[model samples]
Target: MKYLSLLLFLVSITIAGQNDAIAKDYYNKGEFEKALHEYKKLYAQSSSNINYINQIVSTYQQLEQYDEAETFLLNILERINYPAFFVELGYNFQLKNEPEKANTYYNKALASIDVNPNHVFGIARLFQSHSLLEEAITAYNKAKALKPDFNFNLQMAQIYGEQGDLEKMFTSYIEFAVSSPIALNNVKRAINDFITEDSTNDNNIILRKILLKKLQEDPNLLWNKLLSWLFIQQKDFKKAFAQEKAIFNRESESLSGLEELALIALNDGQEDIALEIFTYLINTAQDIDTQLSAHHNILLLRTKLSNKEDFPNIKAQYNKIFEQYGKLPQTLDLQISYAHFLAFYDDKPEAAAQVLDHALDLPLNALQEAKVKLELGDILLLQEKFNKALIYFSQIQRNLKNSTISQEARFKVAKASYYKGDFKWAESQLNILKSSTSQLIANDALELKLLISDNKYEDSTQTALKLYAKADLLAFQNKKEESIIWLDKILKGHKTEPIVAQALYKQGQLFEEQSHYEGAITNYELIITNYRDGILVDDALFHLANIYIKQFNEPEKAKALLEQIIFNHADSIYFVDARKQYRALRGDAIK
Candidate 1:
């Protein structure tokens, strides 16, 4: 008997749900008369069902049966005393051009809110649905007054923003963030819609004043963190560093945030501030790993930012660090970086090879030895010792089979082969790396493979391709002027060849790397103009956009280029980055 009852109950629910779905389908198909007929039947079966009643009323309104909608709303209001029904009746009458009756019902809805604080939400939602911003604000304020812990600040902030009350919007967002800590990121996102990197902008000044005032009134750590975030948004790393320090000291947390800030500063070209942050961490960080990382980054920053004349001093500092830390696994990255600095910048590949060879003698794990070998192989390849480089790279591949480092070693081998004019071997290695676990390596392998295969058949002797590869190797070796010279040879001699686009793109990259924006722009624009459908078109567009935005401060031109990538090259590897940059340049809020 119980099983029969359960089956019957489910059958009844199924019938009712099917009836509801049929009515919805009718409404969606614009067969409102049929929908009304179905909903009226359902309402008769369940007279107390509010959903059925609301759907019937909405269907009436959809069919422009405003009088019927008003009648049903009035009847429901008499039965339930729901404040939202009054607003619905008012809207129905307004739709029927009965302004006086609409006003009366609207006033009743507002008056009904005072009878029950919880009804304020329904009244506010009704007002918001009708775009009555001021009325909705009053209703929400009433509810908050009735319930002190009520959190409508985020909603109010959105409304205030829509109403152009930016100060109030800012205040409301901050209040919401204070009440709900997890919503801090949301608040920052909302602020990003209006804020920009210009420190002298009005919005920035207003935000700064508000933050300063809050800090003076209440010394909360959230304010400090937010101020730090604001400074970062403005690209004011020095001020951001000060605020992050305040947050760290107040909270006594780990140095993770400070470390991240330093990296951000470094990436943003704030070398001095990043150096200061790293110096502070090296002296104050409790963990040895953090100290070592800071030391490594400091050297990296010096190598990137310091003048060539300071190479000897930087070398002496590296020696001092190696002497203090000794040759251990913990300091291996710094040691490797020092080797790279010596080889690439100081033109001391022999010395760089010697350092790595000594580091390789330490008691190291497989990965560590692989890393050292990779660097050694690179230096060897740089010195044109392709056979020696191949040996080291092959050792890593044998030791760490099926690993990311193995794939990296294979890529180096292919690169070395390509540089040695052994196209057949290089093409074989590159084909295997097309499915590499690392997307970057896979893309690189595919690109190099395409370059070799595409240009190999263009010329019988492959002189242009060989020249381009030598130029690429020179660029890799930091011999920029020499690389340009080699590239110029191809550009002048092989004007009609497909290699011209490749050479132009490479020259553009070298110029961009050297901060020669106009030169880079000229080459990139040539690729865009002359080789619009070529493989490097998107690359040229993206680099040109980056140069315009970051160096030339011409966001409009940058936006145009990014748009080209976004619309013209959806399948391009730069598609995602281009879209993000396009939105950011257009001042969209970034989360």
Candidate 2:
């Protein structure tokens, strides 16, 4: 009887080892189906062995047999009472998009845990996946209460920021800073964002004061990052300069604070202060990247402060940058910007055209060629050389048919026609362009169509006026080049009558039609100052305000004009629009 029992035990051990070998071999060979079969047979024989059960469950889950995995896990949980197993089951359910089932298993896991931080974190992550942010935050708080850690606090702060709960976000960051002083950089970034977003709010001011007070209590906490932020917010750029100087003097750290100070000064319109910082950065920065950035910003500031007399030096500097970095592909953006500056600011359209011509001739792909051609067209159009502009526009139109460049090219075609005095041809092109896929293009087209069609009926006095009106009407109907001829005839006649105001208004409207907001504003301001009693005065004022708001982003100036229309010309039909605009500018909610 003993010998029989020994033989049976030997057979059982051989079968168990064979099953284990089969399962591992299949798994390692990527034969998941075969591995699952082997694991299941072994799991059935050794039901009490949690390792065997886990293997079977994992194999089943890998095959996406969720029901089978769940059944096996639940059976084990009933016998072993393992919360970690339940958490695994929850994740499997989540993978299957069965949120309710996932939540049930997660809750079950939570019930088994006395205070398991890992289980809490898993639950929080699940809630976060579903965008149940408040629930996630609560669960994260539970995990933190059990054990405050860096990762958990960082996650909590990020979640609050995503929800735009700035106060909570700041507080969480502060908590993280208290726990780990190395996280002070994160705290400074959060505080900066909070103050910027709520610049006018008393709460923001108080929070800043509290942060300053905390820093004062521990002067050692006054790092370069914190000092840069504090001085920037207070607009005490001189102090920011000193702090950056101190950082470099004491620690040999690079003067990164100077970049921040320069940006802040530039934003506050303290151009001289910005220039001072950039000059310092240019001299001090050892990295090539930092030096180039400083030089670029300094040049931009110089351009902003320049008059016509300063253009030659600025142009020379731009040329020097191109000569130094022009071979690098990374400098393409700087090249394009410099080209645009020459075209618009220096009024050297030919120079702009030449730069873009060179860019087009480089080892560029089709997309780059198309972009350069579109910009070349814009420069030529700005210089009032319509026929030369058409060549570039047509090239983009033919080459990049379905691209954004093609759409922009088509719009410019109509604009070039308008500039050449072909109102009829411009209008026809604009009418088709009004249905463009690009919203900006469509809006410009529609606005041009309206200006042409609305003003034609009002031009009836001078014979030249009648002809120009006829040409504009034809342009509206799509006879662009013909319309240009009519406008030319009107200009040749130079009839000094009410019709002249109409002609000037049409000229200004043409500029506006081209998205040349500065030119449009100039022309509109001329009409307002020169032809104040003319019929288009109210229209000019309305459009001038629009240019300030939409193009210049000067809401204060826009608001003033809107209010002026409501106060000075109450009976004008633009009064209602002006009031709504005023309310919008004042940050009032529209019904």
Candidate 3:
């Protein structure tokens, strides 16, 4: 008898759950009549189920039966004496356009809050549901006043933002951040919606003024963090750095946050501010590792800012850092960066090779050894030492067979063979690397393989293709002027070849590098005019539009070109970026 009774109870519970689910589904599908029927049955079986009661009331309102909803709530209120029913009754009256009756119940709901502060959340939610934002705010304020420890700033900030009262929104978010330090990122994300890349934007100006006033009033550390964030959004790295300094002093925190900020500045192309921040880190860092990293980054910054005339001084700086730090495993990145600088910028391949070889003599792991060898192989290839370069690349492939570095080394081998005009050997290696684990390497291998296969049959001698490959290698070696000359040679001779479009595109890039916008425009126009059906048309359009937008300040012309890409080349790889840029140039808010 006991086992049979247990089974019966289990079956009853399952049936009840199914009925509730059916009611919810009907409600969601807008079959309020069916939902109301189902919910009423459930409420009869379990009179204490508040969810079922709420659903029944909501379904009645959805079906435009306001009197039914109010009658049900009033019956519940008479039996249970719950204060929230007043809010439901008020909302129903408001829905019926009975403002006097609605306000009476709304005041009753507010009056109940004084006796019990916990009633505020549900009452405010009910008011907000009916679009009574002012009443909702009043209810929330009353609750906060009754309960001194409550935190309602986040809710208030959201409401203020919805009302388009940005100053109040900013202040409310700041208040929330002060009370809850861990939610700083969440607050910043909310603030980002109102600001833009331009600091002079009205919202940005308003936020800056609010933060400045907050700091003047109390000098809180939160204000400094917010100011730093705002300045970064504006690309004002110098001002951001000042704010970071204030935060560091006020909180006595580590330099890690400031280090990350400096990296942001560097990546944004603010060399002066980045250099200043890095110099500060180097001077103030107590640990040897941090100091070394700061010094290495300083060298990198100087390298980027260095001209040909400044190479000697930059080389001396690299030597000074090397002499101070020595060739330890911790300093490996600095060594590789220095070697690259020597070979590429200083034009001293032999010297660079010697430097990396010495670093390889240190007690290093396999990855470290592979890193040095990769740089060494690159230097050798740059100097046209193909046999030696192939030897180093093959060693890495043999040692780290399935590693990303191994795949990269294999790609390098294929490129080296291509540079030497050994097409068959290059194609073999490229075929193997077309499925590399590294997407970049795979893409490069596929492009190179296509280039070789596409043109190898065009000319029995492959003379023009060979010249084009050499020109590409020259561009890779930073010899842009020479690369342009070689590309012109291909253009002048192979006017009708399939490779001419690529040649023109390459020359366009080189012209842009040299700041010859008109020359770049001419080449890109040729590709678009004569080779519109070719693979380079979308590339030409995007680059041409970028030049017009950024360098020439002709946004209307840029927009026209970008639109061509959006409409004509819908399946092109540049489609998404082109559409985004088009919207941004049209002053659309970037969401």
Candidate 4:
């Protein structure tokens, strides 16, 4: 009997929910009479439900029965003690063109806030819902003044923002964050909407002045954190690093913020500031892992800035770090990184393989072992030991099934096959990886797949495709001049083939990497003039524009190219970046 009753109750709840949805749909569709009929039935069963009551009152108003809404609201106020009813009454009066009576009831709602400050929420939300923003602000401020403990800063900040008072909004958000530290990120996210990437932007300046003034008034680490975040957003990494250092000095704890700031600086191409921050971390961080991370990053930055002559020095630095940290499980990531540097830059795959094999002998977790094996596979792939590389990559997939690294390993498997001229197997692997969990791997896989798929049918021999793959492999081996030479071979032999554009784009990229700007520009221009409809046109345009803007001081040409990207290549991955750069170049007013 009890089970049967429970089933009946569940059915009743489902029906009630369905009825409410139907009533809302009808109201939205302008069938207010039907909505009112459904809402009346619901209100008869649960008259205290605020949603049903509001719908009923709104239905009456939609029917132009203002008197009925007023009577219903007044009766509810007499029985229910809900302060929001005063707002409903006021709105109904306003609808009847009775501004004086509306003001009276609005004041009554404010008076209820005076009676109990906790009543401010319902009363203010109701007023705000009716677009009575000033009344809503008054209710919140009255409650705040009446009860000192009440935290209405968030609400008042939102209302102030709605009113276009950015100064007050910034002040309120800061105050709320200072009082409740847990809400700092939420407050920053809200503040972010009003600012711009240009530090000189008026809105950005407003936020900066507010943060600086707060810092002067109170030497709080919170202000420094906010200032750091703001400067990072503006791409002023040096200033952000200074602010981060100040926060660390005052707190004397928490390396998380500092580490993240370094990564942001690195990703933004502020190599100098990233190096400075990482150096500071290496010197000051007490935790072994943090210290090791800083050491690893410093190595990477140094290598990026190094050339063939400086490779020996980089090797010495790697040795210095390994000597200090010891070749153990704790230093596994740095070891793997070291192995990669040896193979890719120093052109010593044998030595790199030896280092990884030694590291593999250590006691390591599955993920760590997989990481080491992934690097080993990369080294083998770089050396063109395709079968050996496949063995390691396949090991990762079987050991760490469905993991991101496993996906990466799968992609590497496809790449190895491509390098070996096994296009059929490569395409098969790439098709599965089209939906990879790692977006970078998936993008690479798709690009490679498309390259093979499009050109394989053009020639039975695939001679041009083989030549292109060989040149791409040379480029991966960091032999840019040789890769450029190989790409030239393809251009000479297959000028009329579809692979010519790809070869041109690849050679352009190699020239750009070598800072051979004239050569790069020549290649990109050929693509622009001859292959504008190809997949790499936007890429060629963007890189060419960057060189003109940064290297040639030709802003007008850059702007024209960026315009093409905005209007022509809307679906390009670089569209958003291009639009932003274009807007900045055009001197559009900061948002």
Best by lDDT: 4
Task: Check candidate 1 and list the clashing pairs.
Answer: none
* lDDT winner between candidates 1 and 3: 3
Enumerate residue pairs that collide in model 3: none
Choose 3 or 4, whichever is better by lDDT.
4
Superior by TM-score: candidate 1 or candidate 4: 4
Model 3 ranges with Cα > 4 A deviation: 1-63, 75-85, 251-253, 397-404, 417-468, 486-506, 522-546, 555-591
Of candidate 1, the 10-residue stretch with the lowest lDDT total is 582-591
Cα lDDT tens digits, model 3, 141-224, are 999999989888998888888778888988999999999999999999998877776676778888999999999999888898
TM-score for each of the candidates: 0.84, 0.46, 0.82, 0.88
TM-score of 4: 0.88
- Report the C-alpha lDDT of model 1 over 432-492, residue by residue, as the tens digit: 9999999999989999999999999999999999999999899888899899999999999
Residue 321 displacement (Å), model 1: 1.3
Q: Name the runs in model 2 displaced over 4 angstroms.
A: 1-173, 176-204, 214-270, 273-297, 326-348, 423-450, 453-591
Give candidate 4's root-mean-square deviation (CA, Å).
3.4
The positional error of residue 32 in candidate 3, measured at the CA in angstroms, is 5.6
